[model samples]
Target chain A: MIRTENLCKRYSRVEAVSDLNLDVRAGTVFGFVGENGAGKTTTMSILATLTQPTSGRAYVGGAEVTADAAAVRRQIGYMPDVFGVYDDLTVAEYLEFYGTAYGVTTPVIEARRAELLDMVRLTDKADAYVNTLSRGMQQRLGVARCLMHDPQVLILDEPASGLDPRSRIDMREIVKGLRERGKTVLISSHILPELADMCDEIGIIAHGKLVACAAVEVVAARANGQRQLAFDLLSGGQALAHAFRHERGVTDVLTCNETSVEILYSGSEEDQVALVRGVTLAGYPLKAVREVGASLEDLFLRLTEEPVLPSGA
Target chain B: MHNVLRGWVLHNPLLHKELRQRMRSGRTVLGLSMYLLIIGAVAFVFMYLNVQGQTLLLQPARTAELFTFLSYLQLALISFVTPGVAAGVISGERERQTLSVLLTTPLLPASVIFTKWVTSISFLSLLMIMTLPLYSIVFLFGGVAPSQVLAVFILQLITLGAIAGASIFWSTFIQRTGWSTVLSYATVGGIFLGAGVAGYLFDSLSTHMPDQGLWSMLSGICYTINPIYMQAALESSRGFFTPTFHNSLVESVFQTVKTHNLTSSGSWMFFMSVYVGGCLVLLGLCSWHLRPGTFAAAVRRFGRWLVR
Candidate 1:
């Protein structure tokens, strides 16, 4: 398990991470979602013990990161967003090198190296120079390297940041594999959907403050008390869209095409029913209507659209 | 003891990795061969001169000259190679983004520093050992005794340690490899320049009055402080050995070298103690600074101390 209480880090005039309170359970993946410079990497770096927070305490596996960094380090495996490899070393040697550095026993390192290489699917490139591997291969190799010590927790920062679609899917599967192995993972990424499918809980940060942290579905559904409704009309689409924009609960209307439009709806089910009934009674050719489910993307955009208040506020 | 030693070497993957990367390439072999070639050529040139002059009688002097020349050459090689070997070690790791990951492992900063320092010195130690046969040629043909040779080597080893400590310090303190290397060379150059100025001043002053002046005393101290100059004092030392070997290996080696006239004047022993202590402190500071926020932490402590 990993936890942070009021963690803050500042660099001279800039506050990188401010008053962040986080708790990750023992064997679940927690997705950290934020845009560029949203303190995601800064938080991960503090947890990974690469940087010391200016204030507050962080613990991994019951060991405080600063007071007992050695213990925390032993329990956690960390992967930075962009990493460099030893070009001179083969994949296996690179893994072996870190394994020995992590103080894994000889037999255990050998056995786990084999299993991890297989898990990350780098067994075939075991003898190939790391520099010769593609970016995706190297990312997979990083996963394998992180797992070499058989750590209980993994803190991955943008593990699929620059990967192709296929590689991202592959990375997702590897993370799924980690979940199956009962390892706690704290993953941060700019991809909302990537986190939505994999994370049990998601934390959305904005402007150095955490705006929301909840279950994946809960955060998606709590999008500023609003939802969207799509209206597919056979005729009078433009006129209906214009009329919908003036409706009491409809905040805005978007014309998707000549026959399809979406209206931002913020009202009760009775109100939505009344509006639809009115549209039908007015003799407009209404084909179909469906309420759009709020997604992480919508929630992310809503939360980040306005300047975020500090956590305490 | 056996298990501890085995664990120390076996558990040190950084050391093994560095050695593997360096040795697997043909570069180390090429460097060793080049080292042998240079020492050999110098010996051959001296041999040719001796034979052409038909001076078998001056063979003792020539052998002393050869030994001194080769040892200086060895010191120069160490001076030239140490910055290249050491100045990029920690900075290169940081540049490659490996230092953060390395720090996150259970390996202590001390361990990282020690491993890199040992790796650098071990290669130089190997180079010195490789040239031992050539050194043996100088030892056999000269009035130079075994203790004097040992003293010279002790000086060279300490010289290597001093240079390595300085270079590794710069490498850890500076962010870029190129800059660290330049500073490492600058540190070496600064020492040589200071000593050269002192030596020149001493020469100029000694030619005039019975008074040797401050530069004369400083010159003598620099001769001991600078290992390259210290070798000259060691070469002119006693031509034989009579060590009582009562203390430890290091202490006895110092004692054997202490029998020389330089130590009788107390300057060599004083400089050796201070220089070795300074090297250790430099290494310790390098290790301490490798931790995160150590600079800010140190600054805070210093501020608190000032307030107090």
Candidate 2:
């Protein structure tokens, strides 16, 4: 439901976001992963219609952001990275204020207020002053505020940034619930594992470019060419290494101890099976043999490696 | 139009919420109370002084004149107080990061601006209204006309509206609420002080009968263009105490013949119109400033010009 075509934003002499292209389909959670200064916030701000792009174009819900900003705003909800809470207001009052801003009828807002607060698990804190709540509670309140209008799209920047483990888990569940409800969410976060768990598709940005964008599994597979295999042999370490050394797909096999070995091999499932058979036939007792897939953390680091353009060409 | 009205109606919750928050805020309450105390002390001193004179007390017309004079003085005080009340309206929202939430809503920028202005000036107007009892006490002595009092209060509200509009306009340009507050005060104070000084010097030179140098040119401009001059002229003719400008070549030259014959209320109405018009212009400027692309580009252009 959101797209940007080579969108660029320049602040005086500095280019904050350049040649950035993004497409987020409806009913999917798109994770925007980036380090600091990756222009994630700038891109989100442009999408939110809070700031105008210097060049290029962006659209939300099929309406051009620059041309039909108010319409786009009506269709999307934006929660900033550093969302500030009005301390004096109660949680209910805070929601009510935004409800009015979204042009929801008072009765509808009131009816939905209880449901939203319950969804965020802030029902007890409805009458509590917002500032008195913990940071995680405040962040949940911000999420609830964005949901006040039942917006079709949610652009949340770093919604899980500062939350504790339990709060982060809660946030992930809330996001998953949004996805299930068919709301498109574009979330940016530093925590790749959490994003991997929640996002249907991922975009890794670095130095103002979307360096990698794909499904989590696809990205992990591309980044990891070789599968890692570890075994705790009942007897044979030396013989297993000797046998693995001669194998075509197995490249590096290191003996961990008297009974354990680790191997790195670029091979299909059949090749892995054949290696297992060879180990068995070699008369060494095999206790375990399994392929290890790459983690999101590993893929993230690999894709975000510094770009090295060749020297002086 | 229906959407606009709906937006305006929707803004009331925000308005009510803001007003309640301001009332509860210690700084706002403290500032307002201090202002009221100062006004009370000033009124007490003025009443005591008049009681000591006994001369003003004896003449009913003079007493009415004196009350009108005090009312005008209160209007001048409101002119100063308004910017302080309104300088942070928009900037404060930005500082709190609530502005983005407001902007993303369906509410138009003008409605936002209008609602903020009304909320701020309503606070100032409440303070002004509190002094009504003091005015009524003066009226009990049978000197000031109710029409005169009503006219002055209306003028004060209009002037307050203008100041509030100007402050909000400036608030949109600056980042920090504190800086906006300071800059608003400086701007409003500078205008009144500058105009008063220029008007005084020109009046002095034109009446001194010496070579009317630059002062002669400015005197014509001041008489025709300055709202303060219009106010002073209207007040002076109504027997309120104000400096008398001598009938001079410049005054005759610049003064519209038809305007010169207008009654005091008519002149007051004219000045009020100017004040309201000035307020609308300021509101328009504020709305322009709040538009997405204008503010940042303007700042960049200004920075470039400064560098050059």
Candidate 3:
């Protein structure tokens, strides 16, 4: 539903977004992860047609963003990280105004307004002035405003940035609902775990570059054998460590306590099993053995870390 | 086109909403009261002077001249006041942070500009209408014809619309509401003052020679190009039926005041056409400047250079 080719946005001497390529499929929730100043907002703004890219091209729903911007706008709904609400307008009035702006007919706008307000769970606040609502409620209203025209693509920039824990959960559920309704969504957020739970595909960007992009499961699987394994031994701590020191699959082992040891290993599942058996036969009573799966948080940190440059001769 | 119009009308709820809010606003009420007080005081002083000197009241044409004179005074007041009403139209939206939402809609930037221009003029129109009773009072004393009054009002509306349009355009170009408002006033004031000075200089330079000099030709061109000059000429011709009062301060100040004759002049029509056309072109330029791609490109380039 969205694609960019060597997209580069330069402001004088700073490259906010550089040579980045992305393809987000229709009906999939794509989470864009990045730290502050990581080009997430800049990328989203370019896609929203709120900013022009310095070079390259982007297409939304088959319409070239630069060449066919009006048509692209018709198909995409943009919700900025911070949007202003009319202080005097009721929630329903605000939605209706945007509906009209988006060229929705009166009757259709009314029907859609009702549906969207309900979808965001703000039906009860329809008559309430937007400014009178709490921050979370206002954010929900922003979501409803985006959905007013029934857009095919949705770009949400940090929709949960300042929300409380409960509000964040509610936002996640709303995003999940959008995915279920077959809308292509691109969400940017700093919370990696929440993204892991909600996104069908994830991309990690750092220093204006997209370092990693793939399905969550695929990224996890690629890091499988490279994972660190932790073992809890009940007794024979010194002997078990000595025995595993020369094992083929185990690269490095660190004893955290008298009963627990962590090991970095490069091995298949069978090799892991054999290593566990070898440890048990060496006289240490094994209480528990488990392969620690790399969390999205870990993956994000590792990918964002700057590569070390070789020293000059 | 139908959709565009409908979307434009509905998209800017702020237009009507703002008009209604201003009408009920305390500031507006105070302004209206102040205007009425000023007009009333001026009329009262003129009437008292005429009543005290019975010789001045004998000629019925003098009464008609008084009404025409007062109408011109009102027009002058509107010219000065309309800018204050419109200077904040677009800049205020940006100040309130509502501009982003308004800009993001499917409505074209031109539509937004047009709506803002209309809203500003409409507010001024309402104030003018509210002062209709004052004009009506002029009729009671005799001498003012309804058609002459109507012509003056219409010309005032058009001239004010042009000024307001220019102000709105400037507001969109500048960043701060305060600066835009000040700049708008300065620009309008500058144009009026500059044109008058240039015209006078040309007139003086031409008189010094037996032949019409370059300065005279330039003066004629400037007057023909200026919208205010066109409006004044139109009003003078349409209001030719009224007689002049030589004793009034207005008459002494405007010694060349022409009596009413409604026949439109070719030069007047040319100037009016230019004024209307220039307003449309400015509105278009404002819209183009506010479009997303233009703003984005400027911002992106500036952002890059700033980082370096």
Q: Give the runs in model 1 whose Cα sits over 4 Å from its true position.
A: A230-246, A253-262, A269-302, B1-7, B53-58, B199-217, B240-265, B292-308
Cα lDDT of model 3 by residue, A1-313, tens digit: 9999889999999998888899999999999988888899999988887778899898999987776677888888888887767656678888887887787888999999989988999999998878899888888888888899999999999999899999999999999999999999999999999999999988888878887777976665463436578888776666666666888887878555568778778888788888888777867788998776557887788767855112110
Compose the digit string of candidate 2's lDDT tens values, residues A1-313: 9998888899998888777788889999999988898889999989988889999899999988777787898998889888677757889998998887777988999999999999999999999988899989988888899999999999999998888999999999999999998999999999999999999988888777777777877666655667778877888687777777878998688446658888888899788888788788877888888655557887777767858212111
lDDT score, residue B145, model 3? 69
Tens-place lDDT digits, model 2, residues B1-308: 78666556545666767776767678877877787788778877766765676744455654554564566567667877877778888888888877886777766677678888888988898888878877786666664567767766775677678788878888888888788888878866655666556656786787687777666656544443344455445444565433222447324322432234333455555555656887898887787667665445456668888999
Q: Which TM-score value belongs to model 2?
A: 0.85
* Local accuracy of candidate 1 as per-residue lDDT tens digits, A1-313: 8888999999999999888888889999999989899999999988988889999999999998887677888999999998899867899899999998887878998899889988988889999999899999999999999999889999999999999999999999999899999999999988888899899988989877888887887766564577778888887888888777678998788546668888878888799899999999988888999876567887898888887845632
True contacts kept of each: 0.74, 0.51, 0.34
Runs of candidate 2 exceeding 4 Å displacement: A229-290, A308-313, B1-6, B9-13, B24-31, B53-57, B61-69, B204-217, B220-231, B238-274, B293-308
Q: Judged by DockQ relative to the true structure, which candidate is superior, 2 or 3?
A: 2
lDDT of each: 0.81, 0.76, 0.76
TM for every model, in the order presented, reads: 0.86, 0.85, 0.82
Measured with C-alpha atoms, the lDDT of residue B88 in candidate 2 is 85
DockQ of every candidate: 0.52, 0.40, 0.33
> Which has the higher TM-score value, candidate number 1 or candidate number 3?
1
lDDT of 1 by residue, B148-224 (tens): 77777878888788888889999999999999999999988866666655654665676675875664565566555
**For candidate 1, what is the lDDT?**
0.81
Best by DockQ: 1
